[model samples]
Target: MNGTISLFSAEASGPGLADLAGVLCGPGRMAGFGRTAARLSAVVDEPWRAHALARECRRRGAEAQVSAAECGRPLVRTPFRVDLLSLERRWCRGEGKVLPEGFRLDGGMLRLWALAAGSPQGNNYLLALDPEAPETYERLIAALAQLGVPAKVQRGEEALLRVTGRRRLLRVLELIGDAPLGAEAAWPSPVPVVRAV
Candidate 1:
């Protein structure tokens, strides 16, 4: 079974996103979904991976087409180019699935995951989760805490989990390393802002 992860991008940057995409659509290969446009797609022969791909795509404001080929083969493709700029606004308000079993959120992995799905807006960084999986969100909250990054999980239509404060945001970004394309300028620096007494 050949498995691959695909990511659609206008430019070749965002290694963090690419890494997360690799894990999301991996145990296979990573390549362009098609020649129609600038799209990143993973080719996986297994049904389970395809399902995971579809779920992850939905969570990231994209669509995953399984076996969209001439002969109805098992070739998964996410055609809608993921717009990272507005991803948080889109997915936060939508429905999503739980993290697949055995998916670890260690420092490196978490960094990549954040880069792929996180949104750095205003003074905080938001990570949206599917309200369907409260348990998963709880675990995520705990894990972030373990990493010394305090986060708050707000239950609502968007079900947002925000990492506030410049210190925490900088720590999260430090873990994430380099930001994705179009995101470099937006990455919050490690400089701390002084508050008025």
Candidate 2:
């Protein structure tokens, strides 16, 4: 077998459900809600984030819908998909969603996360994280470094992983592929290099 992760593979395309990890990144969560059918949901501040997440779900063969949430935010949720029960098993540890063992980050995963949590702060691109999950943030830093992109964690109520510099920002943008429609404001911008003429 070839030594590469295929986009078609079920094991999340890179290693350990990276595609699904994208779904769980940021404020996303999976819940069984006292039943066998599991659902994934997240409250995103921007309308574009909700729409983008719904599209990502559809791309993975899951039906998702966007709805208004409290605090005037938009929420993207999947119907109680019995199919997602397996994911719930991996991510849901009793109450909170936790990263599974051997978790790795991939482009698709980064794309989904950047939709809901990425932003440019000054010269750095910041990817938000759940402050409660310190381990997850730690692992994320390691994973990005493995991909040749070093990141630093800025802890706070809403923690952030800061990716700085032109080359690193470009690398991050390359990893996430393309920005979704209406995400121009929420996504990071890599300033084009200008030769001093």
Candidate 3:
């Protein structure tokens, strides 16, 4: 499954709440959980992303809320629930994001990350990495490579992973599936998919 980037096959079934890991991968954080409970908050660039992420969290059985942050960015977050404890423990390393020893990226997780901070620049797709947690960048890039989406870390004001080449971009589409409804960022490059009628 790690060799010969094929666009047809599915990656292995991910573990419980693996999609939530994507939030930590980007700008999301597993915090605010103590007296009231624990919450997972993700600040996104668009309103559609707020709704999309909330819906995904609900689909995963978490109660979610979407609202605009003080910075005016839309924020989607889950309520303090005991169910999220394991996730917080796994992703938080003393207040920083860190992948568990063996975490896998699935379509849902990839979609969440894309919704959070991914964008398309020309023919290449760029995924923003956490500037605070520079240590996890290599692991993330390696994980993407294992999933057949080879990417390189592009250092800048904010670090990013740029996925280049046509086949690799197509492979990204296959792995992450279709774009979210009402999505405007178009990280996967939402093209007019034609069908044979």
Candidate 4:
């Protein structure tokens, strides 16, 4: 239930789920987007939650599969693959919409960027945002500053945002909410190791 969010429930339709979906679609560690299909795979710690997620996926007309995790790993893998071409055709015919909320657009994009390539070291977190849209990246930087999360953008093939301190990284995480398991595991522990002599 930690990283899982309800996407199809009427009461669960909100910015949080939208943002989480964006992250899943953007740079999903266990997910992939292709020209024809969009696939999502996540390892949840609970079996029921994994089945629930699969049910949601089935309700949305996607192929869903759930498998128990291997020994020593207490997690279940749930994978969903949906045909994007059909979805796009339906969208073009005004059947569905996948627009980010105006107020949370920045936060959503930031979350996607972080999930795609955010690296948290001892006291710093470095994130790379897609440079394909420079304007969007600028807006994200401005929005982050407004929220008091100091980030410096470095221009290159793929623009990089550097969050210099641990406090700022934590604030970023707070704003973005849940991240992928791999990304979460990549974050260095705040408590330094003290080995006994």
Candidate 5:
């Protein structure tokens, strides 16, 4: 399983994420996550939805920025964690199984599992693990529905990690720089194998 995490953005600079940071740390903590990137990655046919997500993040308590990408799948930056994407990747695949449909077994597009948080704006957080095979999409949807945060698997058309190694995620940020856009196009960062030793 691969690990990856994402935050919402608004105004192309991650207003949603900024808002989240403000609320969580009581001001000025937004920078803990880092600056926002210029562009970001999203499920292939859902740029607008992605935009909505960024706005939502601002509403939560953090700031976000987009990163650039040749494939068009964007990335973002934050100040709270070490290698946000890599951290997210570790969270997702660490305890989860490989999702058959939403994402590939190897690190490719991010496969997220959102849970209901009960917040007024809609409480949902991503699960660290990927989905397991034979775990029908319908079942996952039903589970999320029970939690009150309905979700669908988000996969992209582009294969960002076909032959790439997991360590490439770190290089992504280096390659892009602080343009706040595509500074790190690394999609799914390296994660410990779910069942492998």
Candidate 6:
């Protein structure tokens, strides 16, 4: 589901974003957070129970934050904003089962756009971290592709490349759907892409 979270943020917008945010940050929606581990044992597979997930996130270093939105979608509150409800859904049972946190890519470029090839919104996310380990990023992108996400991997600043000047890559990504990062899993990943020039 981590793949979905990554993909969702990458492709999120419109009503989908709102419905997800409402379930996450809404008052009384996270009531499950205050329960004992045993009480939540059954719903352990369901992370949308914002309260419980919030507690877990806090434990994992996700601080409490509020997002403002004109409509219903929750806005990003941090450099790495996420809708608890949407994230919860990704972590749920069935096809939605997301990889555990350890399976996710932590450092690299994480970008969120209003539309894949449209204007950027003020709410987009752009982050740069030391590149992830090759295997990790490979697993991450491969996981995304398996889940129907479009991804591209490049060398050095390539991963940092944006849609501003490049038309072909974006078109290809959109055309093929999502793809895995380029580079063999056996190699070391490149540096983190903090900005594109």
Q: Which pairs clash inside model 6? A: 1-98, 1-99, 18-73, 30-51, 33-51, 33-52, 149-178, 150-178, 151-179
lDDT of 4 by residue, 1-197 (tens): 23543232222342332333433322222333444443454444345444544544544455457675554322322243444443333222232233223333344545544544555654666665543334445555665677667777876665667677656665565555564444454342343323334
Off by over 4 Å in 5: 1-46, 74-90, 94-139, 145-197
TM-score of each: 0.46, 0.82, 0.83, 0.45, 0.29, 0.25
The TM-score of candidate 1 is 0.46
Locate the minimum summed-lDDT window of 10 residues in model 1. Answer: 1-10
Clashes of each: 9, 0, 2, 0, 50, 9
lDDT of 3: 0.76
lDDT of each: 0.48, 0.74, 0.76, 0.46, 0.27, 0.27
Candidate 4 regions off by >4 Å? 1-17, 20-112, 177-180, 188-197
Winner on TM-score between 2 and 5 is 2
lDDT of 5 by residue, 28-129 (tens): 111222332221222212343234334444444534454444567533333354433332332233334222233211101111111101010112122222
**Best candidate, lDDT:** 3
TM-score of 2: 0.82
Candidate with best TM-score: 3
Q: Per-residue lDDT tens digits of candidate 6, residues 1-197?
A: 22333333323431222222212111112212222210111111112222332332343344434343355433323223333443544333342233335333211112111111112212222111113223334444553344344344445642321222133223223322232232111111122223343
Clashing pairs in 2: none
Candidate 2 regions with alpha-carbon error over 4 angstroms: 1-18, 33-35, 192-197
lDDT (Cα) of model 6: 0.27
Which ten contiguous residues of candidate 4 have the minimum total lDDT?
Answer: 91-100
> Which residue runs of candidate 6 sit more than 4 Å off their true CA positions?
1-14, 18-32, 35-75, 78-86, 89-136, 143-168, 172-197
- C-alpha RMSD by candidate, in order: 14.2, 5.6, 5.6, 9.8, 17.9, 15.2
Error of 5 at 34 (Å): 16
Alpha-carbon deviation at 13 in model 4, angstroms:
9.5
Give the Å error, residue 49, model 2: 0.9
- Residue 113's lDDT within candidate 2 is 79
Whose TM-score is higher: candidate 5's or candidate 6's?
5
